[model samples]
Target chain A: MNMSISEIEHEIIEEFGVFENWVDKYDYLIDLGKSIPKINPIYKTDENTISGCQSQVWLHAKCENSVIVFTADSDAIMTKGIVALLIRVLSNQKPEKILDAKLDFIAKIGLEEQLSQTRATGLSSMIKQMKIYAFAFKEKL
Target chain B: MSNKNNIQSLFPILKSSVNNNKLVYLDNAATTQKPNSVIAEINKFYLKENSNIHRGVHHLSQVATKKYENSRLVTQNFINARHSHEIIFTKGTTDSINLLASSFGQLLKKGDEIIISEMEHHSNMVPWQMCCERSGAKLKIIPCNKIGELDLDMFNQLISNKTKIVSVTHISNSLGTINPIRKIIEISHQKNVQVIIDGAQAAAHVKLDMQKLDADFYCFSAHKLYGPTGVGVLYGKENLLNLLPPYQGGGEMIKDVSLLKTTYADLPHKFEAGTPNIAGVIAFKKSLDFITETGLGNIKTHEDKLLDYATEKLNSIKGLKIIGTSSDKSAIISFIIQDIHHYDLGLLLDKMGVAIRTGHHCTQPIMKKFKISGTSRISFAYYNTIEEIDHLILAINKAIKMLS
Candidate 1:
């Protein structure tokens, strides 16, 4: 059985709750970044790249059996780690469910600053792009 | 407390903490923290003397105008310009360059050439490209060598009868390589072509004398010199300023307005359009005073020491390579650690309360020449100490270990 978006978010929150210090949290994030499956080189095209990020990020999405799957990569590891966390919750979900996902776990995990407009990380843009893909796929269905 | 501590205390921001650690501000090249005196002046201006300058009979207006003009004079003395009228208040270095490009660019025709270097900031480079696009002029580049220094041989060959003006940065914001402006000015003048020095990075670090350097026009921002933002200075030779057309027309920059023909105001006013940043301009005098009291020679010595100390320590780290190794570099160090991304290092360091700039430092061409996306940069001011550099080194080591 697959977990719902909220369940996965709760699991992430519980996992992050164990770390008392920023260093430990960041170290775990870096480890997660290392473990995340690499995006296929064929999918990393200019059309798939998200702009406004200090570091380049490529995101690709497709719908299979009414479920949307996302594959993404970033040259910067920290950003890639955040992308991995995002992909975990949003990918492999129905288009309507992906569109309605709250994504409150980012703030709950203390990574809210990355979503701020001031931060050049473009985490917010990544989330938006995911939703846009879901919306487009939803129209097709 | 030591003398350095005393100086650091004057900047209240230095006492603040980031992420539960003391702020180790190494981003001085982006902008300097203001001294208490400069901050107080801004408050005083807004609280007491708030009025529009020029063409006012009110007492407050007269006082405001006097203070504003006094700042222009202070700026004149700061850069050792021949006349106060030669100094025009601008929005910032970028604004000043755009103004020059629009006005001076009007003189260019088809087949004329303008020379710039490979290491210019986007502010200095883009304006000329736009100018060339509008006019039928050509843009020529002075190539940079392996060490980030300009190839003077190529520069000489590039300059010819068709070259109208040569504009280059006084110091590379990315590489920190201090270009020999005196030599560049002399070379350009031999061909009877004018030169504009983009002194945005150099103004705070070096002593500038317009008459001594003899550049046709020089530009810089006040925020980098510990003043408020939105204030910049454009120093041009009086004869040259007289020849160029006005950049913008508004209330202050006009002397007479007729239905058909409107005569423009004189030299400085002609260039200064709109009400301007009055409070910023007035408060900038305090920053100039602060620099004057501290002595440029002493500031340079302190910063040079910090640069040398940081360079030696950073080199000891394995897989770390320092870019822009010119012997005549400023207090900025741009470095890349092998297998560690610059953005990751920057994010980790920021978590540790070490603020350093990462990316191309607004010089993308130099990064292309280097064949890298970006490098981490740490720039120093006089208030920064040797201890802070040590903190940075420790943070970098910790960040690298975590990443690896």
Candidate 2:
């Protein structure tokens, strides 16, 4: 099945909307983080580590067949859950689409306003790092 | 304990709510809630006497100078220092300790040693570490046991003629261990070594009688004692303070200024160079007065009851484990639940209106020694009540249920 970034974001927003409370939404997010594809141990070095994060978060991306594939992990479960949400929306998409995508699902999911200032900065850093990867992969092509 | 309600009422912020629920602030070890008296005193100082000290011949300057110097006298008496001039005001405990490190550090020879405890806050550890590096001196650490009590016997063994300074925390911010400071001081004195007590945590819980401990220097942040932030007191023995050079140089700290040469001012001012937090220091006198009126004995009694009650209640929870278990500990209760990340627990509990501190409490060595990432700390104050604690327990239970 093929989906655009907006469609994928809509699906995620709908899933998050199913939860009635913040706790339930958080539980779902944690579960999603648990399911996040493990970043290769070789790529978990400081080189791949994202700065400005409260927790140690490592993201690795590959441009496979002109579509970006993202994998990530974190020492903290909450941060890992957040990274998983990013991976779900941004991974396996074209470099141009990834770079240009609105990805307003973060706001729609109430994360931007809901998160602590520091954590929100961490979230943005992760997104920025992912897009940089997409731009680099596009450059290589 | 009978006037517990009266004591709580003195802090205006205590009446406020968090997330529509009554605020249960158990983060006193981090900082304390200011009494209305202290706040008003600071406000009055800004309104009535807002002039810089020791400069102009104006009336406001004279009044402000009188108030600031009087606060120093109050602090000297509060800490039982022999002379008021010994109390050098600083930005905070970190600034105070850093001052000692730089000033006293210059006196150190190449092969000298500086000793710090394993459970010291980063403020206590980092300054000495930097000083040692700068002076080419050796840095040593005193180890602690499983329950976070410093090993005095080991500490004594580490002391030698080369040991120039033994710096330690009077109370562990993360572990709640009220250190055997007097004994440490006694032993260090045997070696003729100077000891610096980081009283940042203990300044509120314990009465600081400097004469009793006999530490060469003692420093504490005023904010932790319900005074304003950005102001702290560093109390040094008069003779020792005289020997050490000035930490900073500015307007008030100089007696005479010349392009070729300058003469430094006397003690306290020599160390306090720039424009100090004038309002903060003056308001600190009110905080000390608030504590004195409340009576140290009463505060201790109230805090002990809270500690015991919280310990017993949290102990009953099956998966929860208290981190520091020393019998001689103070009013802090640090704990971690099985398989629950402290950040998650802290985040959820914060939403439920319970304000507790999570993470290493700026003591990574203690966390490393305990072999855990961090523990959530719930430190009590005289203003905290049993009902607020009940709210905390309920919030914790809710967090566990949601996360687990």
Candidate 3:
């Protein structure tokens, strides 16, 4: 609950220095996806599926000590990587805090302008699903 | 003999020095490039004869109406339909399917069943899904084999007395498997079930004879057949269409509007409401003309060669896997390389000026059956040559090397 979001952002940016073009930036994003721990297979089922995505993605999150910790996986590797990036940015936070989080992290990472409309939509849907979880968790809290 | 040199010359895209580079367009499955003659006909419509059809008293309107009606007759002849009245102009194949589903689907009872195949595109599948959901009717699927061919025995076993509608694709866009539509129709008709054939993929490559096939409803998109977008044809037997209620209520589809009772227009007009895609409908004739000029047989021969050449080249690459190998396929070849993602491969291929379709191709059910996330598809048209296939092969080889 006391985690510094900006500190994590600074570390990510510092770890992968600013690149010349979007191509280099995408490699960094892909690397960001690779760094996250893989989601467990048991949590992946029909209940956790996203409707609009072309791939089968599953996400599981639990609140421990008032901190939201999330785990996600996908049948698609890149999509799994995408979910990992999403989990890094969105998870392990309170419901209100997660709901108020800025989605401009995509632009900060240089993916907003670089990714195609289809890929952007997929990312947007993942964010929406996370928000849905936040809203559901908010009521219980 | 049709020389390869002359055949290449026929396609202006191959010859035109655009941006000082030869355009290697491989997105033929999406929509094909139009010939100069077709372009001129469209231009002539806007320049010389441009007016509203059916309701106009002016000379230009008369010409436009004549052309529009003539296009219908031409399309009817092309598909060998019983009458021009059966050909209803729609926005696209999606619109045609939606219209049928909304109207005929409303007639289905709670326990009634509708059958579809696994190889259907989303347009064919989604409408039926919605239809069954709305009507409380059960939906059944005829499973496709690993080779992407339909299991005919499974199809026959699925047919029962409670089955009200049976819809299937004439050809698989992702697999290029040409289905046995006639046999399916016969099987469905035996149980008094109506058959709707989604001809979106088949219309471009194979010839259609609606009467011979005896399908109750046949739908296709004009854009898929080298014609303009925003226009398609829905062919239904006269009696069946009459039996089904009107889909949309609007102008031109009404016989009389009254406070007490309203009567609908007859035949195709009842299905077609309001002002249709006039320009797209008019230009579609030229596309059909182009096909007639080149001949469907000639077009099929050209595309088959390209498919063969591309398949052989792609197969030679190490670690590459080809999906959907049916003996009776058209011109679609879908594949993926081991350990390399399809999207990554597509991005690399595009940089080399080769366009290909990547991902599920709106056939998620088929993707689920294959147990893979997705595959990269290279679909061919009549104008495509072996040289482009070679370029595709080279680009794919380079892409795989970059990833590995």
Q: Model 2 over residues B284-372: C-alpha lDDT tens digits?
A: 99999988887788888889999999999999887999999999989999999998878777777877878998877888888988888
TM-score of 3: 0.82
TM-score, predicted candidate 1 vs. hidden true structure:
0.98
User: Where does the lowest 10-residue lDDT sum fall in candidate 1 chain B?
Assistant: B1-10
Per-residue lDDT over B1-404 for candidate 1, one digit per residue giving the tens place of the 0 to 100 score: 18899999999999999999999999999999999999999999999999999978999999999999999999999999999999999999999999999997888899999999999999999999999999989999999999899999999999999999999999999999999889999999999999999999999999999989999999999999999999999999999999999998788898899988789999899999899999999999999999999999989999999999999999999999999999998988999999998989998999999999998888888999999989999999889999999999999999999999
lDDT of 3 by residue, B1-404 (tens): 25666766655666654223366677777777776666677788999998888888999999999999998999999999998999999999999999999997879889999999998899989998999889999999999999999999998888899899999999898888889898899888988999999999888898888888899999999888878789999999989988989999888889999988779999889988888888789889988988888889998988888888888888999988889998988889989789877866765566566778888888989998999878899898887778778778877887676555
Q: Which candidate number maximizes DockQ?
A: 1
- What is candidate 3's DockQ? 0.20
Lowest summed lDDT window (length 10), candidate 2 chain A: A113-122
Which predicted model would earn the best lDDT? 1
Question: What are the per-residue Cα lDDT tens digits for candidate 1 across A21-91?
Answer: 99999999998888888899999998888754368778999899779989999888888888999999999
- Stretches of candidate 3 off by over 4 Å are A1-52, A55-121, A125-141, B1-23
Candidate 2: where are CA atoms >4 Å away? Answer: A14-20, A38-47, A51-54, A101-104, A113-116, A119-122
Candidate 2 CAPRI classification by DockQ: acceptable
Stretches off by above 4 angstroms in model 1 are A117-119
* RMSD (Å) per prediction: 1.1, 2.1, 4.4
TM-score of chain A of each: 0.95, 0.91, 0.77
Count of clashing pairs, candidate 2:
0
